[model samples]
Target chain A: MDNIEKLKLTCLHDLHVALGAKMSPFAGYDMPIEYAAGIIGEHNAVRNACGVFDVSHMGEIGITGEDAEFFVNRIFTNDVTNAPDGQCFYGMMLNDEGGVVDDLLVYKRGHNDYLFVVNASNITKDEQWILRQADGYRLCLEFMSEEMSELALQGPEAERVLEEVVGIPGADLAFYTFKEIDRDGDTVIVSRTGYTGEDGFEIYGSHPFIRQVWQALMESGRATPCGLGCRDTLRFEVGLPLYGNELADDITPLEAGLGIFVKLDKPDLVGGEPLRRHKSEGGPRRKLVGLEIQDRAIARHGCEVLSPDGEVIGKVTTGYRGISTDRSICMALIDARYAKTGTGLSVKVRKKTFPAVVVPKKFYKKSYKA
Target chain B: MIRYSKTHEYIRVEGQKGYIGISDYAQKQLGNVVYVDMPDMGDELEKGEDFGAIESVKAASDLIAPVSGEVVEVNVALTENPRLVNVDPMANWIIAVDIADMGDLDDLMNQEEYDIYCLSESH
Candidate 1:
């Protein structure tokens, strides 16, 4: 009864239902939120062992032509030039006013060929934005989201599972690298990248190929079938930002604590001048920080953040009980003066105010390979 | 006898005291129960009002009072193992209350009436 609008399904929808997954509407897709193992178990499975996710709802766009690399570096905040082939970079696309358009991954397949992976909810808007900015650039852009299906095999045992179960050769892939492999007269692109902080692999293939890999991994019983529910928790525990919650149309990477990915010294790019000015002057008016609540109440997204004197400052972007660390923590964007480490703050959870303390935004340490 | 409310809470009367908890349908919908915030003893609960919150893995829902009463006891067992609600909602009553008045029972629905209400709400 939650969703009245018609929902879209992925290639693994029937398989999720057959596995007794709890279905919910997320980013216009009827996706599985969790399976029979539940969120906590699946989350632990990824942290301790291996887990698989159907990330086909993500958007993929391909650009190829004479001026493809130039067009990409013109709009993206990162310096894509001089990077080695098969290297992937994380950066943001911003509007002229410095507000974020989307945070995406840029995969360099060759000198003039690149693959851009974006969030599912911002597909149409991102496509339109790219087209609008392609006035004088000579590049052929294609939205390949529908033709590509993605699966994230994440955990400590990911490499072993990929080799033993799926019969895929991917042990040599370093972090942030990918290669196209030939299998049975078809091509499958495997990347050593993941949303979770654990060492993992993301496999992109055709629908039938993805379905077969999912079945093979499930039958092997070495990889747990995870859902979108744990995906949020795992990413949040490592202090990664979700699009709508942390980086939105109104939030800039500088204000969201993602300035490292923004190369302000680049010759030119969208929102370059404004971001450069902000970087040179410490930061923007508001800054992001971590809050450890002294109480058990979970301060969820949009919860009002206030100073100790009860003055309204900012709001919480993401909050949860850290399943890995066993602490009640959250990320909030507050006035720069109140964002200092060890600054005392309070959050309004429902009808009561709870005391909280400012801390480093990284709640849990990342355990990535390389 | 037992009765249910439109908000999915059920109450079982024993003499002048009543036991209150959510129905099985609600627990199933809420998914895994992680924490349950309950009211303290000696707190006054008004009819058709929220007393505390029950948080599941997905979201939090308010626990509404089925009848006006004064809370006499709480389910201390749920504080340590809240998943007991998901295991057996009816057996794990959340709180015990002293009935303020007998007329409040008329406003609630019986078992058969509640079953029909759930069916209609689902469609």
Candidate 2:
């Protein structure tokens, strides 16, 4: 059963192979790691112009019926009921222990019909958790993962590329907002949201149509083909926390420094009480902070972060050294005392003690379309 | 003379001394080489073992030794300018070793063999 319930493939899986993309397992699909042009070329391509990503593996499930808003609001810690139509709110799906099940986006298409954009790897878990949450509630929920393909066109030139293929001006779409555009009698919800910290749009539609759109956009937009390698580095540069690295079943939003998106004042929501108490009284024993090493040594995940006196403080969650930065920068969940803007520390990588300093990150300030 | 190991490192061997670095194929595969973690000059290295690390924009990889030897020299330029490897990997040998395992070179790729290997990959 486990082997049979293997990872799913997107419509562009064939294209990835044809383009000589080094494929690897990500989320639930055999996705590309890098192309012949390599990750650096892809990373620089996105940073300079536009890059097209086959993010079709991301899950899209819808919730409907009259009590949909009420049901979603109760399950999410954020004020889901507050968003007007065509707006998306970023929030988390939390377990009873106040740890994040997954960080997701809630799109309010209508008062009753809404979409939940979730991480690809957690689709099964998210779907099951939602079903359990809705079983005793008054809402009709549906997992639309089988019915949709999601694609993201990201980079500084995302708007230009998308506008060319979609044949519609998308520059007006505000951040975290979506519009149902007519594309040959099919409505694809195009949202001005992306994970690369660049101005981009995510389009959702049927499998075949999504494939056609990918081919069309790749041709007309002249976007560089990017794979998981560039995607991970780009997202990391922007300080986005990946689920497995920064978020765990035991990792709270407070520790991840994502509490701004979690609303404590919300009524009738799961995990709000503990989160509120955490907010007021401080429950985050450890907090994620960005570290810019003074040297070239890369501090890998799980590397020991030590105090000046050689006491263990925390561990590196993710580290990346890029040509653009010319130095290694790491993110570690450390005690709040050392998480200050300029606290100096040490990272024990292998047998060497590399000098580390805390710095404000989102390493590349977002250059998103307004 | 350019020689390569299956693990992707290449060296220009001459007598008891040689300059070492990754092959063009390896550098091309790794993408925009960024950081290189070089061991101190006197550190010992074993054949087929990791001597240090090389970071590309996307990820970091360990640098494996093609021959067991004592590290008699290192390219200090790498600590400041890692692009030297990406610019001319053939020219920038990472280490100067008193190769303890001289016979190990036979098991690695000579320039002609490596050239054919790269050619096959294109097809």
lDDT of 2 by residue, B31-102 (tens): 677778888888888888899888777667888988888899989988788878889888787888888767
Off by over 4 Å in 1: A1-5, B112-123
The per-residue C-alpha lDDT of model 1 at residue A31 equals 91
| Candidate 2 docking band | medium
Give the range where candidate 1 chain A is weakest over 10 consecutive residues by summed lDDT: A1-10
Which is the leading candidate under DockQ? 2
Candidate 1 falls in which docking quality class? acceptable
Each candidate structure's TM-score, on Cα atoms with residue i matched to residue i, is 0.94, 0.92
List per-prediction Cα lDDT, in the order shown.
0.90, 0.83
Q: For model 2, how big is the iRMS in angstroms? A: 1.7
TM-score of each model's B chain? 0.97, 0.91
**DockQ each:** 0.47, 0.68
Best by TM-score: 1
lDDT (Cα, 0-100) at A256 in candidate 1: 93
Model 1 residue B81 lDDT?
80
